[model samples]
Target: MTTNTEPALHKSLGTLQLWGIAVGLVISGEYFGWSFGWASAGTLGFMVTAIFIAAMYACFIFSFTELTTSIPHAGGPFEYSRRAFGPVGGYLAGFATLVEFVFAPPAISLAIGAYLNVQFPALDPKIAALGAYLVFMGLNIVGVQIAATFELFVTLVAIFELLVFMGVVSPGFSVANFVKGGWSGEDAFSLASVPGMFAAIPFAIWFFLAIEGVAMAAEEARDPKRSIPIAYIAGILTLVVLAIGVMLFAGGAGDWTQLANINDPLPQAMKLIVGDNSGWLHMLVWLGLFGLIASFHGIILGYSRQIFALSRAGYLPELLGRVHPKFRTPHLAILAGGIVGIAAIFSDELITFGGQTLTANIVTMSVFGAIVMYILSMASLFKLRATEPGLPRSFRAPGFPVVPGFALLAAVVCLVAMTYYNPLIAGVFVGLMALGYLYFLATRSRRAVRAATAV
Candidate 1:
């Protein structure tokens, strides 16, 4: 196993490229997952839910930037928690990050399959999904610069497509369409809709799900101290605007119920505006693939770093951390994540007790992971602020204790809310974490014994 850490990755990313990395990590999110919120809460309720979630993320990102710049490590939340709370905390943080970064790609990969099928009706979506995994993983393994440059290109395309979507749908956007009958077909908001609004939190979170992933790339950044703040602030602004715009337009474009649970909400929304065979629908569907591709390729890059950092620190098998001799990338880790994602795509038809699709179940499980990481990371930030008072921070979170506290509280609420709404999905996630922690325990003791014996 190659454990050398002196030169693990090429240091070539700048502010613009980092912006690409951050934006690309989550642009696909704006296209699909958030609409699932509408299924439970309807358009207006989901919109209200989205606004709160967006505020939580805004606070989270500001706090996370301080952690990234102060530590400047590829381990992200893992590194931050390890410093503040020790080994067990590190494992939980790392495992949550792995779940967040690794599982997200499968969801995006499935969307890629759905988007491709729009153009090629004969192609099997399963094959297309697996094909997306193989192709993007290969690109990431080649080199970070190439992968990042490609990310920038596709992100720009995705951004332009969003602008075009908003323009095309704006003429047809009626506030009445978005708000009227938007409360799950009920006359008005009631006590019963409270659970639904909470249930919608996870889907609303999808709008900016992995943008904090920029922190994972800090170790490879040319000037993470300065660039990190710029990347994060700019990245969140981009997403917030995009999220609100897309959600409002998508909801207002048609019979909001038709879009609540689908994989490709944008194309469907456009079809409603322009009819079944509009030339606009065909163009948007093709360009929309860029949005999905941006997130897929960027996340593979982020998860590889998460894997590399953990394995190198002995949290996982050292071989999984091995850097490619020529490419200087975590090739094994990339392939491992890819294999698991391909497996998920194949098993995408499973159902939860709530009759949610495997994709919905997986989405809930991934949100659980994000919630865990957010709570820990925010706590780490609060702890570090008190303990490491003079840690030479380049960027400080805006409201200090208040901001991190709000983020922590918001994350805790989301965690409890989602678990209450989706008990089966919650149980499955807890079981998975238990299995991983067991592996960690066995390996940690074995390593200690080996060290003592060597003496």
Candidate 2:
């Protein structure tokens, strides 16, 4: 219960709405991005990577729920780390969370634009991406209830569409298709496949990347102690099932290679089964936008809250902490994050490194931030358990020590794997972090001097 003078977030979100936000924050992965893993590891190898990532998420979310319930702040990992380790720890967590939330939306927005381009051949995907930013930022600013409700609707539609896709493609699914050349160009697992599996770590992570973002909304949850655990537990379960189902079904529907490296794999897989002009294929292209929209919109919500939280704590400029007087939303924070996302969208073609597009690079960079934050958040959980034994926790993580320890270990392994596989992106992530840290130190020193003068 860290109190602040800034306007508070509205408590309109319940368990179901929180569940929606949790799922919506990550549903886009079910649409695309994860397919790139196939290019690295093939279907079977990627599946193993995905399952490992899912287990990490399951443990992380269960453990993270205790922090969310006991502390219940919009800063999420930032608040937890700050409580555990002080200002520098808080700054690192906040910066990483900001990077994760801000960069994620651009990737999803570009995907939204690509999905739109399939329907409108002449419309520039960049323009569509910018338009999406404007629309969703406005929606988020107008009100949280409206935004959360819309998120729930789109998330439900997105889930239904995924189910529809699996059913339609099930008839075409075959074990032979899925396992053919599945292990990094071999039919069975071998030591040679390990590199591909490691290479595919980032994509496997994409399957459940932003689910922890639900903690960012804990301050707005009506009954966080009870609602959060239920929402988080259910949300992770739902996403794990969908991620596995979508990957397996799509891979088995046709030549798995055809689905790999493509943004709209579901439609392409369906086209193989039902012909090019099948209504199902067309429907998937159109309705699939809901998945992208859900993630894009929900991430806007997440980034704004993180920005607001950090600013309110004096980690960022005070202007961004202000809630809209009428709307009770972090309007400036929302707009600030939107500007960053739009800039990334516009730079899609301009920013290329190692033959990867801005979206691909940013996705890796975002995962870099997420893994760092996960490690710190788990560390904070362990620290607090030892230091603050009296903290009220409505739900404790099952199998503590072992569970969260596994999560921490997995996150560290993922970070090492990603850095090794994506050296350029890793460098960029580190560079940005260094710049942010410099700013944090400068601002903190100034604040300390001012406090000393007053004393």
Candidate 3:
């Protein structure tokens, strides 16, 4: 008697899906919060932080391009690690990543709720949060094709919204805003506040946090080796340019303080510049909302798939491994992810890595998880290359061991820096990772026992 192996299902994401993940992760709702951090950093600090963040992201993308092309499987980093380092390493990489994605949607949904609350004081955060989850959950559960289409629409609108804000608000910007003092308190111009600039660098770092989604989408990309590299390079360059444009536009506007405080700074900046009488600001607001929604959908798509992939590999429960028969989607995992976001309504408010004053507890948790996963993935790259030089690389990271080496170093530095600055929330992240690793060890012991019994 022989056992039959399960057949594998493949995803061939087109340019649209490719852009969906790329733009979605880069042009995030997180930016709304990031602007405050950048403004507080002042011009030079902002520029420096932006460069550091961009370079780090480039390294990650380049490294992932190599790994993604080789495996080109659904597991993303999880699959790459399993192939290179075996099951335990894969589990850790995948587990850390799952924690991030599972918890992130709620944080993003909370952002939507927070923004909606600004316009509608009566809008309950919970209700708005739940609504956001349903819309995106439905999109994911329905299928990737529909989700991809929706993401395309949302990203397009987001681009238009950003362009409109930039075009309309340019004339209203005052150079004086850039020179204002105490960017954090009114002492920004004071030499004593120099630390504030260093404090502000993390904000830029936070903006570039999720830019790795393009490489993560390797499993679904139409051509992993080719598409992954193109998406990684083109997507990042486009986003960095856009980010610089937004920063310059904001800096040029007279009162950085005003932009820093507003929930949706671009629309408010447009209002301040062009006057509230213009209907375009409202249109831009709606478009911006659409952009946020698009971001929401894209993350859910990518994150849920990450979970499904890991689950299929036996690192998670099989339920998460199920693909909807009709929709060809990860229904259970998508639902599970949305539920976490829905639960985040009850969680505390937590400050984000960006200099922003606050974010939902869930979002902060996800950000921390993402950071941890990045560190793991980068380290894995270094370890795998050293341990398995003979392995074929369809795409190679430029600068040899230097690229992966630097990425690992950057990951360590950022983690330490983020922890130093935001110990409170950062502590929470550490706690979660500790708990996850423990669970990993526990499960492994049980599996070992089972294997022995079978023998």
Candidate 4:
């Protein structure tokens, strides 16, 4: 029988906060710019491309909802993989996931700097980048409550910025921009080749990536089964709908090419539609910046938990597992996150290898990492269905084999689509996962040796 002295299992995260964190990390600020750029790259119609991205995203959410409820733990995708595939597979999946988080902050922080540069030309990008990091650090250090509150605030600001920018400039819209003969010279609106669509899918996946992090919050949730699913479903659908609306409005408004070319699309859209120098639009642009800050805060919290989990499992340094008694936060993991983010900043500042710029390359790699996790995590569902039918699930994936089966198919299609779209980075992701598997083996060997010596 279980003893009363056993450690408590629940954590403090609320349902609303759970949704905010999920949405904040996945759909905030410049991510929309990335999504817009990627979706626009496809041969599909404006609405069609956006919907396709949204649909793929939905599958992930539906699939993960069941897993999160079944195994409400802090490890996120890693935890699910470990349960289904055993230790080594879990560690590798989690390791790949960790790599994505570690790389993401710097890329996002750099994006924030770029947006700030567009708005305030006098400010140095390095300073802007540092400032972004400081803000991320401050929010996370203080507490998750403040962090969640800020995320909620940013979510509102992002939504407002979208509505105002789109509404005000919508009058100038013209369907002519899209009709200028599609990118292929044959009605850009036409869906012609599978090859082109395949090429566009990776870019699209990059935009829609990171929805899986929401499911991981189940361990911290006040109500894991109820909250994870609600947050995952609501947050994703909200972002996708708002994203489509923003895209449609911008495309129709006027001069889609100018907005696309602009380093920061939202601010550029505002400038073009409302006549650039308008103070209100500039202020609104900053508000959009607020969204990025919010997203960063949520991501750091989620990523740290992943780290904390890995460390507990003996895969990472034990120092990472320590939690601050005072703040009740993973202080060491948070610090590690900050350090990695700083390194990322410095690396980004220096690197300009290959034909693509540093930021572009990171974006490509980040997308690849995310898609790998998605494909693997979705595959886990089938494994769980067969191996662990006895496991209790709080929230079930609707339609059983049908819904999950379709999700599995969608994930495979996305993988194929990503590979065809940018084979270089897709290859890199495979290499990275292989390296993770190797690392796991090495760690296991070291542990076994240590145990033998002790015995």
Candidate 5:
């Protein structure tokens, strides 16, 4: 299982596969996560926060593309930061990626159970969720092409489903419904609502949670220097359109209160307009499965690669990095992630401590990872630009210092906001991160000692 260099992941992903990887990793966000934003900040408040977050993501993606294309490493952020600031930076970046990619899918997996519950009332969602983990991981273990092709297929169906949803729900769209209690019953400009806006940042983030996962597939892409940037740019734009459309239509079709605290927002909206027995409601309940599966399966692909990368670099257990000789896939890494994801499903109820459900806390922690990775990766970009001016570049970030600088600043602000408003979740997330980083240090120390003893 120990590898001194990158293990061969089949380089079969072309531009469409790369695009599917990016969009599929994030399509579920448009379906469910954003609803929690309404609970936190009201409709308009979430929009305000979401707009700011979207701008930050655009900047981050542009900057992330430069790093991924130039470096073209499966380790994604870890590889970039390691090159710039060495081991400490690399560990932090990789651990953050774990938090983002690993934690996020379980949350979505739970949502999958919730979706299935609509179709089969007798089935326990948690058990269903655990089953999903087994099925998707099995698919992932078989090979990358099979997994990525499944991702592309489901993502297209999900996208078409979204457009049909927009058409079905659009007739009932209303500014009045959307702005009903738009401040969550707080005074419109009051200081009280400010924290809610900050808290909603995590959920709004769900709208594009794993779009950066496109970079995780860089190692497996053909002509990544060109394909990677194309996938990222197109993926973000596609997500933006879908996010706004789904939010406006769903939020407007029903009471914001009804939509705010549910995982099945689109179907709920359809039920409101078309009634429970309507054909459209049934369409939503089933086809909506594609959106959830797209993200659930794609993010699995992303997390396994991050785990494989970390293990390959000797930052984690070597056994977790092994590629299956026959499948040419990171078999152990996918299995390990699947195990963690199942455990997360059972622990999903542990975070209802302060009016925050397990899903809310999980979403916050994932965003915490995204923030940490973004800040460090942007800093690493700046460091590399200054230290290695003559480095070869196939693609330079469009706005250069300004884009990365803004992305870093935005991430810093979001970090402070999340910590200030949701201290419990933030504290727990930081503690987990510290433990991971310490493990990396201890592993390095032992390796150093062994090398010296041999000498």
Candidate 6:
């Protein structure tokens, strides 16, 4: 079979840059979205859920590294599933990844707008969100090295700001404040609390949603086999610490309920310590934008690469596959994803359901996509291990069946919980996937006919 020829992405990323991409893609979760879990699960309940979700990510990343190092494809899970289960599996994985990478940005962009609104209360958040999409999309189209360098800078600053937040709020930290209404309703866990904890699964998963996107950069990494494992391991450890620390300090600062359901949770938590006019609060509002920007910018890089790979493989429009000749980046793919995000930003008020804003709904939808991709990717690992035993693997998944088994089982539980709590949004996700599958079937049939006619 003849394959499509496409321009190669420049190979300029090293371990540090790849680590930046991996962590930066997810750092924003420490800023805002996860706080919503407090609304459903409260402090103690959410913490329990977060720990479970964190363990699942650790297992998933460890096993996922094996596939990334073995194949080193920009398609990531899509390529792995295709090799293991053929075209149908590839289509499902690719579409799920696209849903994840594409939906996540609008949420981050809205958070960026919310942060900017803290600095300039009169500015409309949607307009600021639109501006963010424009600036970062242009940056990503310029070059991979330039984009990765900027991601590293912002990620480091974001990490520093988080540490500062912990230090500044440490004086007010009290175990009593954190444990008040710790469960969903009452102080202690009960049958009622279980539903709330399950409903909070998506919010907990948000902390590590796009971390797997690191695999999308494997093709552009220098010495991918060595660097991919290092980046994935170090990146997860960094995020897990920051996620737990930030959540604990913020919850203890004041009434945890006040921080729930808002995009500027950090600034609000800081305001409880220093007055609203204090320099510390203002500083957080300013530097906090870097965390949102890092994820916003990095995910744009991620989604574009997914689009480029799928298009190059004859799954999406060919225009999206073309790399810019001068810049050697996926220009059209970047712009295409940006357009979808901008439209979602405009629909912020229109898309709400169950009293949650567009940001929360979008976050749930993105988590749904990520969980599905995790299941398929783990299944691919088992299938490939059995069928292609000779495939060169620089790094092997430790405990093989046990580790991947736990990851896959956890992902299934999360999916069931999310679908139950979010029936409407879940339906929308299913509808989108069904539409994409129809396109895949139509194009595939045409390709088969053309190949036979030429023969």
Task: Note the Cα lDDT for every prediction shown.
Answer: 0.87, 0.90, 0.66, 0.67, 0.87, 0.92
Clash statistics: count for each candidate: 0, 0, 9, 4, 0, 0
Worst 10 residues of 3 by lDDT: 1-10
TM-score for each predicted model, relative to the true structure: 0.96, 0.97, 0.88, 0.89, 0.96, 0.97
Candidate 3 shows a clash count of: 9
Collision pairs in model 6? none
Against the true structure, candidate 3 reaches a TM-score of 0.88
Tens-digit lDDT track of model 3 for 1-455: 00133223347577656766777764764346566464556554555666777787778778877776766766777766666677776776776677666665665666677667756779986688789888778877876766676777777777777777788777776666655542445534556455555555455655565656555556556667667767667777777777777777766666666766444667666666777667876676566777668667777876787878766655566678787777777788888777766665564443343444445334445656666677777776777788888877878889978887787777677667666666777777667667866776767755454335552
lDDT of 1: 0.87
lDDT ranking of the models: 6, 2, 1, 5, 4, 3
Those runs of model 6 whose alpha carbons end farther than 4 Å from true positions after fitting are 1-4, 446-455
lDDT of 6 by residue, 1-455 (tens): 33444469898899999999999999999998999999999999999999999999999999999999999999999999989999899999999999999999999999999999988999999899999999999999999999999999999999999999999999988888888998984688888888889999999999998999989999899899999999999999999999999999999998899998999899999999887899988889899999999999999999999999898777897789899999999999999999998998888556688778889998998988899999999999999999999999999999889998999999999999899999998899999999999999878965465346552
In the range 399-447, model 1's lDDT, one tens digit per residue, is 9789888999999999999989988888878888899999889789754
lDDT, candidate 6, at 395: 98
TM-score of 6: 0.97
Runs with alpha carbons beyond 4 Å of true place in candidate 2: 1-4, 445-455
Off by over 4 Å in 4: 1-10, 29-32, 35-47, 183-194, 261-263, 348-354, 445-455
Which pairs of residues clash in candidate 1, taking residues 3 or more apart in a chain or in different chains?
none
Cα error, residue 209 of model 4, in Å, equals 2.0
- Model 1 regions more than 4 Å off: 1-7, 349-353, 446-455
What value does the lDDT take at residue 397 in candidate 5?
85
RMSD of 2: 1.9
In the range 228-284, model 5's lDDT, one tens digit per residue, is 888999999999888888878887897868877777888888888888888888888
Alpha-carbon shift of residue 266 in model 4 (angstroms):
1.0
Query: What CA root-mean-square deviation does each model show from the true structure?
Result: 2.3, 1.9, 3.7, 3.5, 2.4, 1.8
lDDT of 5: 0.87
What is the C-alpha RMSD, rounded to one decimal, of candidate 3? 3.7
